[model samples]
Target: MLTRRTALLGATLALPAQAQERFPSRPVTLIVPGAPGGGGDFTARLLAEGLAGPLGQSVPVENRTGGSGNVAASFVARAAPDGYTLLLAYSGTHVANPALFRELAWHPIRSFAPVALLLTAPHVLVIRPDLPARDMAELAAYIRRNPGRVTYASSGVASIQHLGGAMLAQALGTEMVHVPYRGAGPAMSDIIAGRVDMIITTPPAVMGQIQTGAVRAIVQTGRARHPMLPNLPTTAEAGLPGFELEAWFGIYAPAGTPREAVLRLSRDIQGVTETAEFRRKAQEAGTYVTFLGPEELAAFTATELTRWSGIIQGLGIRLD
Candidate 1:
């Protein structure tokens, strides 16, 4: 009787292992926590396309936009703990939203499992071409000279763009009133029309305008220059040191997922991101591919949350 019981227990444990080994038995759904045609949507779609062949499953992306990405994040937290449902979590969804929303249904670290880091994009300090300030130094001087007269736009309050702009102001010791918009597209439009004095926007959103000379990209908020915009100087290089902030996106699965399943998914995503096609697409989107493994990705998420919390508190921003 004892030997038979031992055999049954071993079989039960081995069954889970075997199931994990053969991951993605069916179609995988990648959830994008933003509207279609935006960075999160585009990135999720590309990841789905890039992961299909390697993972031996059809990866379909679904957009769920609301509450500044909290809606989709909450949905993912309640999803089945299988590898089929995955989340494309960006800075706003994973880090800032938790602090910004008073009643966020899911905890970023506790409610979901981190798979891998996808991409990191630096925000560009952009202004209308007609603005007199030509570079960061000039912009800083102008803002100090005309405090409260200039307004900066961001996609939303507590967003990376918002924190980036606030951090810049704190470092430069100047005051530039913030104007929050529903999204980056509308904010960029207002900046182009001269409705907003300047904006801290993503490179992908404002790259076309910068190329056309409609908006002047004075500097990028990163530690080093991006390959796509090598000529553009970093914010630290321009004047303010320690002013490096980049928007990052990663993949997550619902918590309590099988450990082996999470490892398998992470390996697959790392492989897909390192592929030539994925790299090319990422570069074209004005971002660099940096896939962090499980432990590193979790640590990075914690750091990002802390960084944004400080900025939000300092700026006295509250979405609630």
Candidate 2:
């Protein structure tokens, strides 16, 4: 008889299937939680271009910079879980922020659906050329000699760079002053000018300085040596065993987004990442494109969250 209650129930039951079938009927927005030209923005734009062809819709990148990625993250977290809106999440937003902040507007793991891991860039430890520390061992000795006097710069408070430096100091059983900057440019400039003793950042940010001899590469925070800086040994090899920190970028949809939509996006993104052109582009940017589907990404995110939360809590880091 098609009563009102029955009609409502039928419509409600049909929504998931209908939404999945007509998913992304319009343009999709990939939110970047950083200023344009930054690593997150670049990764978002690259993925948007690659995804448009596969998704059959224009994927546009929207930059919503603030609160160390909190602004955009909160926006996406509160967005409808319909797959049209997505986030280009990184270690800062998901792993570090959850540990650093007491009250984040969104849950790093629970508020979003993991789609895929797009790329990873190993953090490099760069120091002023005149610091006199030729290797990690020498650097450790130097820090020990002048404990608590050395200053390390980071893009901002609670950033991945800050966490990396904090972790290194903890491992070395020494203390160093942390200097927060507005952005990486100013921080890198200070490091080059010898105002800051060192900075732990990604390769692309400091590769030019290292190449021009303006700064020295002490060690990388990766399990393996970075191909671009083959001469630089990893922290594990350079005395800090088992210390590895690599910044990763991945895609995420708001939680409750249909499973079909999540899987479809992950599959297409995996294809995009495998293309030769995309690989070359990512390499040239000092990042490597690697694909991990939804389940693997979820597992990876869980592990990272647990790992960084402990590190951050142990270091007593907080950001309101």
Candidate 3:
């Protein structure tokens, strides 16, 4: 026989314990900041499938695409920090957007808790099949000779592809007109059709074209050569030292999410990436699985923000 006051006190005392124990009692949602079947979406689904067993809950991926991931980033920023709502953050959203946009609705660093870094995929230098240049050296020389006449296409203004193109131009000390497109599909289509001179984009985006002889692969933009394209040299070996660049992906929960949950989710994600099946699948998906836990991911994000901000500022890129 307990009095009402006594019962209320007992319930209040148990609330914190209940909250602590109720983590992941239901399914978790991993928000992808891109359309379905895209890299982000593919990574999200892969992690979700692997995370369910360890987290003891169903992890589902939801695509919330628009505004270069702003819509999804904002939604995750405002979501309850119960560890249920997470974001599949990438270079464009977390690292590049802060510098590209004059004012973003949500601060990438402040609005989220870094969970883990999932993978990194390097870009490959490609040119039209009939382009006079045969390799990166020849391409650089050709651009030097052609000067402003040579053109490069990017997915859009301020995109990673654009930044890569800019960096390449800066490295070669050449002037090539930047042609922005709505998306990679259109840009790659134009590249295949010889509407653009060249494009430095991810292999997955143009691997089909390369295989079909629609475009020629010249070099890869990574410290080391990609295993899939062992014959191709890296940018450093291709005569552009210090020209390495790769797009990375990570996971994050909204700021103020439980510290315990963040650590738990980070550990689970690391475990997911360590599995043999996951590694093989990641290789198949054209990305190498690299796991960085919360602390490492946070530091990595900070460094990336700084690096890309410097690059964007140097390039004088701004989107309001």
- Leading candidate by TM-score: 3
Model 3 lDDT per residue over 1-320, tens place: 99999999898888876474667788999997766544566678889999999999999888776676787899999998889999998686678988888788888789999999998988888898889988887888899998888888876667788888888888888778989765566678888888998887766567667777899999998889777778889988988888888988899999999899999999889999999998987876567998998888889998999999998898777788
TM values, all candidates: 0.85, 0.84, 0.86
Local distance difference test scores for all models: 0.82, 0.85, 0.83
Error of 1 at 93 (Å): 3.7
Tens digits of lDDT, candidate 2, 206-255: 77788899999999988888667788898888888888888989999999
Candidate 3 Cα outliers beyond 4 Å, as residue runs: 1-21, 36-38, 181-186, 193-195, 212-214
In terms of lDDT, which candidate is strongest?
2
Q: Residue 300 lDDT in model 3?
A: 92
How does residue 38 of candidate 1 score in lDDT? 57
lDDT of 2 at 273: 97
Q: Between 1 and 2, whose lDDT is larger?
A: 2
lDDT of 1 by residue, 61-157 (tens): 9977666777788899999998789999978657887677788889989998899999888878899778898888898898889877788887666
